[model samples]
Structure formats: C-alpha cells, structure tokens
Target: EGDGAHGGFPADGVHRTSRLTAPPPVPPRSRLPRPRRGPLAIVVAVLLVLGVGTGVWYINSGQFTKVPPLLSKTEAQARDRLDEAGLDVGKVKHAYSDTVERGKVISTDPGVGDRIRKNDSVSLTVSDGPDTVKLPDVSGYRLDKARELLEDEGLEPGMVTKAFSGEVAKGFVISSKPGSGTTVRAGSAVALVVSKGSPVDVPDVTGDDPEDAKAELAEAGLKVRIADERVNSEYDSGQVARQTPDPGGRAAEGDTVTLTLSKGPRMIEVPDVVGDSVDDAKRKLEDAGFNVDEDRGLLGLFGDTVEKQSVDGGDTAPEGSTIKITIR
Candidate 1:
C-alpha cells in the first residue's frame, strides 16, 4: 500500500508531469496572407521592360540615318527624298555638267548612302547643264585670227566653207553659223564661211613646161608654186603633171596655184593569164598594177575562160594603164 502511494502518482500529478515532459504544441504558424497578383501589377512589369528597350534603341540608332540616293534627281525630287529621310536641304549650288541634265542633282555633300544625323542639312550640287558663252563677232578677220577668237570664246572651230565675196578680202571670215551675240554652249563647234575674193578661172597647166605654167598663172593674176616632190604620171619628165585648184576651177586673185612636176610614167611587166579564167585574169592584171577591162563578145557572153589579152605575157606596159582581156 505504501509503495503504491509513493510510486504511483495522482491523475492530476500525472497530467502535470506529462505536460512538463512533452514539448508544448507549436502554435499554428501565423503567416501573413499572400498578396494577390492583379492585372495592374502585370501591366506595370510590362511597361518597365518596354521602357528599358526603348532607351537602348534610342541610344543606338534613333538619332541618325543614311543619306538617300539623290544623284540625277531633280531639285524637287531631291528635296522630297531628303524630307522623307528626315533631313534638311542645306546650301544649294549650281554647276555645269556635260553628262548630268540641267536642274538635276549631280551630287550631295554627305554623298549617297553615307551616315548622317536626322534633321541635319545636306548640301547639294545641282547641274546647270553645259557651260554657255556669247559668240563674238569675228567677221572680216583672217581665218587664223578668227579661229583664235573662237577658241578664246570657248568655242571649237568647225568646218570652214569658202565662198566668193566682193566686200571681204580673200582668206577672211565672211560670217559664222549661229552668228554674233548668239549664246552657245562652251566647246560647241561653230561653222565659218570664209571669203574667196573675186573669182578667177584657173588655167590648165598640166603637161605644160614649168616656166610656161608659171607665166600663164601670173598673167591670170595668180601666183605659182612648184611642189618639191615630183610624182610619176603619164606626162613627160620635168613637165607639169597636175595643177590644183585644177583646170576650169575658180580661185581668188593673187591666190597661189601649186604645180606638181612629173617623173614620166612607170612601166611594169604584164602577167601571163591567157588560159586562166576571166576572174583570175582580172585579179592577176589588177595585182600587177594595171586596170582590167573585160571584152566579152556575143559568143563569149557566158564564157569564163580568157582566150586572148591585149598586152601579151612578159610585155611591158605603163603602170595604171588598162589591160583588155577577151573571154570565150
């Protein structure tokens, strides 16, 4: 009984002992309520990301652009193109250009496809076409002097045509095409009409002696000039072979007539082609320095064979003389 009383405890004591020995119940964790994510929060997050992206983009490429292609474009077109590219037109200048059209954009300051800042000015060099100059009066001037004047006026001396003029002296300019005071492009060819004073008939001096030719030309109010180099012609040696301005041609008074003396006709041996075809014979004769004349009679109209030749083979004939061949 005593042991029971000592060893065994009362129910209240047992309960107290159990409560002290065992760990106290952990108080239900008092967590704060999780905040609910709403549409407004999502929107704020998205806006922050967009703002960062925009800042990066603006810093890199937003303030500049490439120059637009403006070569060969008109002023209005270039302006429009620059406007579209967010650029301004700067100093506009005009210059002459042979290849570019007038009023067209020849080049840009920044050059096409070059990087430039937005809203910045782009200088343009517009074409004014070719340069122009006023033609000066060169009438009555000597041909050489007139050419000099034209060159000084930025013009090219073009074809010179001569005509008889009673007022203007020989070898002087009568007038110019496009006339005086006419505005013409620089480097333009200008034709001039030169005067050949009072016409005089040129006497035929060919085949005449040099002394006779000179005397005859002098009597006709013309001067005579003998060429240094003599040419081979049908006329005899030491005789006048050719005269230019030629026979019956008109010339100016006191004008010089040049005479070329002859060194006699050159003789060459003919080729043998009696049995050859007509075409072959002609080729051989022509190659031997002689002109070919085909004599195809009624019977030889369809003949191709050369049966006879006027100058036989191995015979000497004057160079450039005609060689007749009979075909059968």
Candidate 2:
C-alpha cells in the first residue's frame, strides 16, 4: 500500500500478494530460416535458349549447299558423301578408260565443283578398266571380211602374208596372229595369213633323165609318178618317153606327175632289103626297126646295090637286132 506502482499491494495497509517471474520479449530477427545460395534462374534460361538455337541450325542446314567434289572416289565412298550432304545417288554406268583404274570412279555426270540442290541425285560413272578387247575367230574368213571383223573388234590389221593351204580356200585367211580369244589392248595389230590357191604349174621334163625329171618336178612343187608300163620309142632305154598333163600344164600342188619311161625300140618284122641300092637298103632296114650290118667286101666293090640279106623278109626279130646286107 505504501508503493502501489512498484508492487501489487494496494495502497492501503491491506495484504499484498507476490507472483512468478514474467517472460522476456523475443528479438525480431531470430525466427527466420537460413538463406540458401544456388545458380540463378536467368543463367539456366540462357543455356536452354542456346541449346535450342544450335539444334535448329543443325537440322535445317542443307538448302543452299553445294555439291561436294567426288571425282576418283569409290562408289561406296561417293554414296556416303552424298548422303552426308543430304543428296541422292543417281544412275550408275561403266566405261573403259586408259588412265583410270578398274573398280574406281572415273568421273561424275554433273562433274565436281558444281553447284547443286540438296537431295538432288548425282550420276556416277564408274571405270571398267583400260580399253582392251578379245580377239575374234577370223581364221578361214575372207581377207576383206577378216579385216572388217578386226576393225569391228577394235583391232587393226597388221602384216598380211600369202601361203599355200590345202585345207583353206583361196583368198581366205589361214590363221591369225595373237590367235582367237586372246586379250589385247584396243587398236593393236593383228597379223593375217592369206591363202594362195591350190593349183601349181607343172614343168617341162620330157627327154630328161629320171633323176633330173624328179628334180624338175620337185622344183615345180610337184611329185613324180613313174609308170610301170614302159613304152618302145626313139628314146634310149631308161629314158623318159612321155608325160601326162604334157609340158607347161597346170596341176595341184603336191600332185603326182605321171611319166612313161622308154625301153628302146620294139621287136618288128625284117624288111626285104635284097636287090636294092646301098642307101635304099640302109634306109629300109632302119625303117623296119633293125640295125643294118653291111657286107661290102665283095658286092660293095662292084656296085652300089644290095645283093643279099642275112634274115629273110616277113620274119619277126628283135627291133634293135642286127641284120647283114651284102651290097655292091
């Protein structure tokens, strides 16, 4: 009661009641959670925008693209390159080449370094190999026809030779150099062989010895065919009497020349040479195929006429048999 403001006691001298301690007031900044620090939303947004821009650039970058050079590239490689550039592969063809290797690309249709649209097809020309060809079967063909065939096969006619061939016709090819089915470079030379027909000229061999006749016939490209049946003729025994095909006739090469050899004069009848002049008797005896022996010891001293004969007339004797005629 004495201190009403400081204590709860009333002002009066009545009883005062004592109470527990009062709670203190909390500070304004103490209840908040701990502040967190991480990457900014703005930075994340910038990264997202950059990624989208790059993807767009990559997906749509083929409209104004130029064709890539593809010369000398393999077919597979060229196809891959075209695919990478968003282009298509076109028709493929093969051609022989001299400088380009086989199984390699020789060139392109639109060519390298040309401007083209994306997705457009590019034609490809592949190399087969060097320009080469296989020789054809021109043997036995006509000369002119063989030449034509050679030309058609991309070959050239080189040397031409003529020869005798029994199996091939005249003016026809007998054989060919490099033969048939042989591979060679284009425009290469091919030698030709031509036939010279079959017939040959038979030489004149009459009156020649058998050995000489054989040599002559051989020189003329002919063979000999001596006949077994000999003939009686003016030619001496073992001499050529006659020949078939005559002299200076034509015959095939390797043909046999038939020849008839002589066996001297044949047997004949003796003529009546008696009572004839000496010259007349000689002529008569010779004509009758007989050798005349004159006995002029007694008759020949008196006259120039034949007096007697050794063999009677109309008698057969050896053609070359000797006969005696007494002449005066």
| Best-performing candidate as measured by TM-score | 1
Pairs with backbone N, CA or C atoms under 3 Å apart (clashes), candidate 2: 1-10, 1-11, 267-319, 299-328, 300-328, 303-328, 304-328
The TM-score values for the models, in the order shown, are 0.55, 0.39
TM-score of 1: 0.55
Name the top lDDT candidate.
Answer: 1
lDDT of candidate 2 over 70-114, digit per residue (tens): 877888998999899888999999998787787778888677777
| Tens-place lDDT digits, model 1, residues 5-54 | 44466544553433447778888989899999999999999999999988
**RMSD to truth, every model:** 12.9, 21.6
- For model 1, the stretches where C-alpha displacement exceeds 4 angstroms are 1-60, 71-77, 97-104, 127-130, 205-209, 227-245, 258-328
Candidate lDDT scores, in order, read: 0.93, 0.84
Question: Worst 10-residue stretch by lDDT in candidate 2?
Answer: 1-10
